[model samples]
Target: GKDGSPLLCGSIPGLVPKQLRFCRNYIEIMPSVAEGVKLGIQECQHQFRGRRWNCTTIDDSLAIFGPVLDKATRESAFVHAIASAGVAFAVTRSCAEGTSTICGCDSHHKGPPGEGWKWGGCSEDADFGVLVSREFADARENRPDARSAMNKHNNEAGRTTILDHMHLKCKCHGLSGSCEVKTCWWAQPDFRAIGDFLKDKYDSASEMVVEKHRESRGWVETLRAKYSLFKPPTERDLVYYENSPNFCEPNPETGSFGTRDRTCNVTSHGIDGCDLLCCGRGHNTRTEKRKEKCHCIFHWCCYVSCQECIRIYDVHTCK
Candidate 1:
């Protein structure tokens, strides 16, 4: 049995001829019928772990086992990508059913499934890595209508526009109440900061403080009256403000304003900043109640004087 045959030579790895290394590597990497059958058997074992399964027919066993093997292979590819790239990823147990409301999947029968895991990259530019599955590829190709609907939704929801990248998760739970097909996408945090920055641009600094209160009923109403025509400040506006001499000295702080003894008194300046009225003084004098009771006096005279000053002399003009 120890004859100098090719099979015997190949079986002994170190003894194999250098010329045959390529062939050996190819054989090692290539898929085979035996491997496929073994994979099918393993999948069946995973699916019915503790059950005594009696296959009624050969066709039934093959039908039941085929998809499991296919799924395993797909998952292996995803795992390989994760390992190679040193990226963290996760698989959802099921597809997002209610996402139609947020992601707009209702208008169409089926949509691009969200699944897979995301990894944080070192740089802002290196944000995400994705491993697409064969099923996802096929869905995109075969289902034109569904794909189109998803594309439309992605555009509308700003997912494609806002998100950096997307990848399919190589896992599936049974498609029942909601399709268990999983998928996921990556987004940059800076993109979400736009809304907050825009809000701050339109609102006054006082409005920002009042918004933190428990009950500030008239703040929005007051702001709307004056700043209805105000647009969000752009980069140009910020640059101009930075370069302007009046930007910093408009309201120089004499001392810390919100301490227990001497609180910086806030007054209401009407929509045009033309009518300033000191509605109250001290931290506790606002329409909204403070956490601790304050001893500061709420002077009506100061409120009236401030209002008169703003209207008559433009005392609180923005620098």
Candidate 2:
């Protein structure tokens, strides 16, 4: 126990070089970092569960998504952005919760007091979280390639989403239920809200073209909007350089597992609808019985008794 040996930071898998450096330097923050990555991944799956890609992860490898993220598709942009945002969100939350000694609540007040509210509570320090996320997530995009540029942009967009949603949360202080003074603090939005915002960004993501030029050191790739009339995407908009595959059939080339057995909503006309999810292949319907507690009666002692009931419903899956 006395020996100075690297513990958790040394054993974590899938970290690139720069991330390893950051991990070793800030070992105490690693748990929050891991939690952040998990949050990002879980949110990604939740947001894409009804879609073709589905944000599936590989169990056998550290690169969980495998080569699915190797391309510069809109999916890749969403993943990068969400992951980055997740890291920041988690770390910022940890800071407010007093999990780390290196950081704590933000004491800097941006402006003067509003109406009756004054800055007094411990505001979440998101800037530190963003810095740590950039150090680790941006480390993987060191190369001067088009994909790297696209990824970095999307990552920033994810972090910006958090910043954009930050708002003042206030509590009232007064005599006997009357409002007299209000203390406020800056707080991050709920992670689900962030996920929903990112999903919206994914749907309307901008398509970009790669432009390579010679610099003093070597060639560098930059991204530009493909369409001329469309307004240029800001720092908060997701950008992709390549289109995603249809993912209708299993194709190893495009890293698509297909939607052959995916569940579909029969009544929906949107992306999750059988018509779109099945790709015109139609769907198969089968009856499923579900058991649940049905009729219940309150007893004299206050406990309730319920009868078991069986219910039948139609289940649909892509053919």
**Candidate 1 local accuracy as lDDT?**
0.24
How many clashes in candidate 2?
0
- Compose the digit string of candidate 1's lDDT tens values, residues 43-119: 33333221212111135443332222122121222212212122111101001222111121112212443343222
Task: Quote each prediction's TM-score.
Answer: 0.15, 0.94
Cα lDDT, all candidates: 0.24, 0.91
